[model samples]
Target: MVDKPVPDATRRSEKSRRAIHDAALALVAEVGYPKTTVEAIAARAGVGKQTIYRWWPSKADVLLEAFLDLGAQTARELGQEPYVIPDTGDLAVDLKAVLRATVDELLDPRFEAPARALAAEGLVNEPLGREFVAKLLEPQLRLYVDRLRSAQDAGDVRPDVDPRIALELFVSPLAQRWLQHTGPISYEYTDTLVDYALHGLAPR
Candidate 1:
């Protein structure tokens, strides 16, 4: 059987949701997360506060969804279908490609400011931090997990190596630099990370 068309009201609601997401990202980028309130998002989005509340309980919730949408948009912009990691049997190549894309995302001006602000907030606010990690970070990390597991199955990665731990060798360093300004973020830097993570820091 064929599916029916979406209702006009549903289409309008979706359009409003997109507007809200765009507004949330813009507000957070402009004003920081703490000052970005529901009323402000409503006004910027051209919707009522009740419209936002009908879909999300709070500003944090709206921002979270907005950030998730941003990730997908960024992925598409980078020529990646969101939430997927390539599993070419060559683990090094696959890892480098993903890391390079991540470096691009981290370096993007549109993403950097708001992400940094939210990250700083997450650092001091334990509950919010946990929510952010659980809602956004972990799911993204799991894509690496699945990719590494594929590599292990292909004998491209050591059987004894744990995918989750192995992934952090590349991911955490990039994350630290991006989140804390510990160092510069670049394609070459992430490429080196993929090498070091896969080939061991010592000899060989």
Candidate 2:
């Protein structure tokens, strides 16, 4: 079969995939998502228009993968698994530890720029917003679900509580702070979140 014509296109496609992801993230960060386009990404990435279309159906898809890749890279650098929350027996300690690390990740420039861009877009783009929540955000949230379930089983958390919703008490507060400039995030803040969530805000 003439050595399959060297498969040069496959190698070129892989390079173009990386380039497109980089370009999409940069464009979103620089111009915001409303003004970003496949044409702009293609030009910035130094690839043909068809190259991006070949892989991702839309800019939202490209951005979603870019954000996921950034998270994975950061996790690898920190020597932690990207999609699992640790259960160290002490529920408060474990939750606080993970949330503290998340505070660091959210504050990092590399993660912040692109994430803010995408989040701003998602606020107005209904379909894209739901997709981001479903695919990228929800999967990560499920990690907390798993951790909380373990805590419930261990009698650290109330078994009657729904782990999914329970996890959100702490998770959503931190997310809101980071997303909306609502407040400062720190180990102390996250620690407080865990404490309040576990013991209840009332006079427990």
Candidate 3:
């Protein structure tokens, strides 16, 4: 069967939805999570609050979808596959490539301010924090988990290693630097992280 053409009204709605997502991201970056409301996002987007409500159940819902959209856009711009980590048959190379991309994302101005705001709120608000981690963070982390598991099958990683916990050796460090400003982030830094995580630091 031939695909039905998209209606003009639906196209208009999609455009409005993109506006809402962009407005929500910008507002959250400026105002923090506690103060960024549905009304505020609608106003910033020049859409009616009812328009936002018609599409999303709550402010958090809008924000979540906004972030998901942001990641997809970034992925496309970078020419990388969205929502998947590359294997390349080398675990260390794969890890470093992903980490470098992450460093780029963390440094991106559009993503940085809003992500920092949400992360700060997530720290103080347990439920919100957990929800964000579950939805936004965990899925990304799972890509690493899958990569590590594949490494194990290929004998690149020790069979005894737990993919979930093992992957954290590099990920958490980058997250700490990004979230806490503990240190500067760079391709070299993340590359070092991947090396140390995969190979013991104590002269291994």
Best candidate per lDDT, number? 3
Q: Model 1 Cα displacement at 172 (Å)? A: 1.0
Error of 1 at 133 (Å): 0.7
For each candidate, how many residue pairs have backbone atoms clashing (under 3 Å)?
Answer: 0, 0, 0
Could you give candidate 1's per-residue lDDT for residues 33-118 as a string of tens digits?
78989999999999999999999999889889988988988888877985678876788888888888888888788788888888
Runs in model 3 lying further than 4 Å from the true structure = 1-5
The local distance difference test score of model 3 is 0.92
In candidate 1, residue 57 scores what lDDT?
90
Candidates ranked, most accurate by TM-score first: 3, 1, 2
The runs of at least 3 residues in candidate 2 whose Cα sits more than 4 Å from the true structure, single-residue gaps closed, are: 1-12
lDDT of 2 by residue, 1-204 (tens): 365564888888777877888888888889999888999999999988887887889888888888888788889998887557877788888888889889999999888888899898889888998999999988888888899888888988888999888988999999999999999988889999988998887894
Candidate numbers, best lDDT first, in rank order: 3, 1, 2
Which residue runs of candidate 1 sit more than 4 Å off their true CA positions?
A: 1-7
Return the lDDT, model 1, position 203. Answer: 94
lDDT for each residue of candidate 3 in 1-204, tens digit (9 for 90 to 100): 998999999999999999999999999999899899999999999999999999899998899999999999999999987677887998888889999999999999999999999999999999988988999999999999999988999999999999999988999999999999999999999999898888887884
The TM-score of candidate 3 is 0.96
Can you list the residue pairs that collide in candidate 2?
none
Query: What residue pairs clash in candidate 3, if any at all?
Result: none
